[model samples]
Structure formats: structure tokens, C-alpha cells
Target: MKTFLEVKQLNKTFQPDKEVEVTALRNINIAVKQGDFAVLSGPSGSGKTTLLNIIGGLDEATGGEVLLSGQVLTGLSEKELSIIRRDQIGFVFQAYNLIPVLTAKENIEYVMRLQGRNQEECDTRVMEVARKLEIETLLNKLPSQLSGGQQQRVAVARAVAATPKPHSC
Candidate 1:
């Protein structure tokens, strides 16, 4: 079996100036096989988000490599990274970053639309995930109209609707 995600000697550093430097991550290593479940748990300020951002292509690592299903993500151009992110990774952000104007259903359908899926397919997948997540009744509601848990559920539904795509931290 091949690794779905791999990180090796991952290092991240922040240098604001000659006198100021902070190391967020150093020599981090991780591997996850396809269909496996893994978790990253730590207290605040533990570089968890920094590591995640680098893995998701939302941030650059100062050193090391990230491989997603065997594709090296470190040196890819922004557009290339964007394509990988769109087609290969689904992110459920901590803040539940739903578009304020779009209803739950629309928010859930957004990624599918970006993937160039037809309306019928997007709608079917959205409904399927909504049902699975028990958020079908909240589809018409705006993000502000739902509770935190509901918003999180919708976010999860949106992430899951983009099925067969690997999810990032």
C-alpha cells in the first residue's frame, strides 16, 4: 500500500528580522496510508495550524517536503498548488468559513461547482452529504441563522460532498 500523505524533515521558521526569529516546526515527520484516520492533538501555540497550512498548500515551508499521494507539493507553482488543492484536498476550517451570502446548500455546492461538476451532480452530492450529516433541514438557512454546531455540520457536509478527494488537516 502506498502512502496517501507523507511529510519528512518538515521545518517551518519565521524570521521577522536579523534579531527576531521563531521556529514553529522542526524535523516533523508523518505518514498516512489511504483510508486511514489520523489526528494531530496538542495545546495552543504548538504549530499545529502551521503544519496544517503547509500541508494544505496554504503556506510555504521553509524547509522539507510534503507529498500528497506521491506528488511533491513543495516546489509547485501557485496555480499548480491551487489545482491540487481543488481536486485532491478538502479542508474544513476551524472557523467554518462559509460564505456569508450563500445558503448552506450553496456553500456546500461551491467546491463541486469549482470542480466543474454539473448542477445536477452537485445538487445530488450536496443532498447526499447533507442527509448523511443530518443537515438537510438546514440547507436553506444562512450561516448566521444556524448554531455553531449546525454551521460545523454544514462545513463537514460541504467537505464530504467533495468525496473521493483527500482531506487535509
Candidate 2:
């Protein structure tokens, strides 16, 4: 299998003041291959979230590099990063972040829309994933109307609906 995502010597530090610095990640390195189910499990404040952010391009690293699909992530502009995030990566936050205005189906379709997928393609893919996860009934319900597990399933479905891209959280 090919490498889907790779991080090398990744580091991140937070500076509240010139004299005070908090290291969020230290010399972290990891890779996920195509079709691989990767898990970043750790206790709270254990850098799992920090590492996820770097992999998803949601946060910057203080040192080292991230490569997704052979493109170096460092020095990319915000727009470029956004394009990469939309085109190549899909993220599901632990928080179950869903749009307040969009229905469950709409939420699933949003990612396809961002990737410039046609309406028919988006609809078919959303339905496919929804059925695979057995969330077809909840597709019309709002996030608030669903249980925690249901919401998490929807998030996963939305992330994986676009098969052309690698999805991460």
C-alpha cells in the first residue's frame, strides 16, 4: 500500500510569553497508508489533538515537515492549505461539529460540494455511506436530535463519503 500521510520530526511549541513556552508536540513522527485505519489514542493533553491538527493542516508546526500525497505542507498559504484540506483530506472532529443550518444529508453533501463533486455523485455517495453505517433513518434529523453515537457515525460517514480523498480527524 502507498503512504497516505507522513509526518517527520514534527514539533509544536506554544509561547505565552518570551520566557514561557509550552511544548505541545516533540519530535513526533508517523505515517498512515492507504486503506489503513489509523488511531491516535492517548490520554488528555498527550498531544493526540496537536498531532491531528498538524496532519489536517489545521495548525502550524514549529519545526519539521508534513507530507500529504507527496506535497510538502510547510510554507503553503492559507488558501493553498484550504484547497488541500478540501481536495485531499476530510476531518471529523471529536466534537461532532455539524452545520446548524444543514440537514444530515446536507452536511454529508457539503464535503462533496467543496470537492466540486456533482450533485448526483454527492447524493449517491452520501446514501451509500449512510446505508453502510446504518444511519439512513437519521439522515433527515438534525445533529441535536441524534444521540452521541449517531452523531459520531454521521461524522465518519461524511468524512469517508468521498472515496477519492484520504479522510482524517
Candidate 3:
């Protein structure tokens, strides 16, 4: 049973210079095996998003370790983390953050371009993911032209279009 993701003894605290410290998480431990489906559920402000952000490398954990695949991500430099995020991870935000001026196809192709993929490859991948998501016809429309659900589908297409390589934290 290979671990796909692991969080060990994790803790997160926020301290303002003139205010009391707020502890967001404490001694959290989690292990997710490859191909497993896990869900995090809690009430508002229960640190679900915080834990996700930390796991995604969008925020730093105050203490403990995060292992993705077999990589330790806790102490990596921002540049290194950026590479990891670009090559290994995909994020779909609750708010669909599409570029207003870019067409749906362009939005879906953005990350692939950032990864230096060739134009033909980018185009192919964008169409493939869009078709899979049943948004093939919407690819030429702007974000504002799409419904909320359509926009969310485009965002998901964008996240998966690059077929980012998977690696452990």
C-alpha cells in the first residue's frame, strides 16, 4: 500500500505582532493511499481549507511534514514549489478564476503553455479535456458568456488539460 499523500504531526498557527496567536490546526496526521478517495468535512472555520491549502503548497505549514508520493515539500523554496505545482499538481478553485479576455480554449491552454508545451500539443489537450467535460462547443466563448456551471466545467478542464505529472509531496 503505497501512500499517495501523507501529513504528519501538522500544526498551523497565526500570530499577529499586537494580537493573540490563533491556532488553526494541531498535530494533524493523515495518509492517503494511491487511488483512494478521501473527503474532509467540517463546519465553517474548522481548518478544512487551511489543510487543503497547506497540502496544495499554496500556504506553508507552521510545523510538521507533507509528503507527496515520496517527496518532502515542507521546506522547499518557492521556486521549487512553483515547479512542483506546475508539473505535478492541479487546483480548481471554488471561484472560477478565468481570464476575462481569453477564450475558453485559451484559458484551458494556459497552463500547458506555461509548461512550454508545443502549440499543437496544447490545442490537442485542450480539446481532449473539453470534449471529456462536454464543453467542446463552449471552447471559443469567453468566460462571461458562459453560465456558472459551464464556467466551472471550463475551470476543471483547464486544471486537467495539461495532464500534469503526479508526484508525492
Winning model by lDDT: 1
Structural similarity to truth (TM-score) of each candidate? 0.93, 0.90, 0.92
lDDT of each: 0.91, 0.85, 0.90
Ranking by lDDT: 1, 3, 2
Clashing pairs for predicted structure model 2, backbone only: none
Model 3 reaches what TM-score against the true structure?
0.92
User: Which prediction has more favorable lDDT, 2 or 3?
Assistant: 3
Off by over 4 Å in 3: 165-169
For model 2, residues 32-85, the per-residue Cα lDDT tens digits are 887788777989999988888887889999999999878899778899999888
Worst lDDT window (10 residues) for model 1?
160-169
What's the C-alpha lDDT at position 96 in model 3? 85
Candidate 2 error regions (>4 Å):
163-169
Which tens-of-lDDT digit does each residue in 1-169 have in candidate 1? 5689999999999987968889999999999998889999999999999999999999999999999999999989999999988878889998999999999999999988999999999988898889889999999999999999999998988877875644454
Instruction: Output candidate 3 Cα RMSD.
Output: 2.8
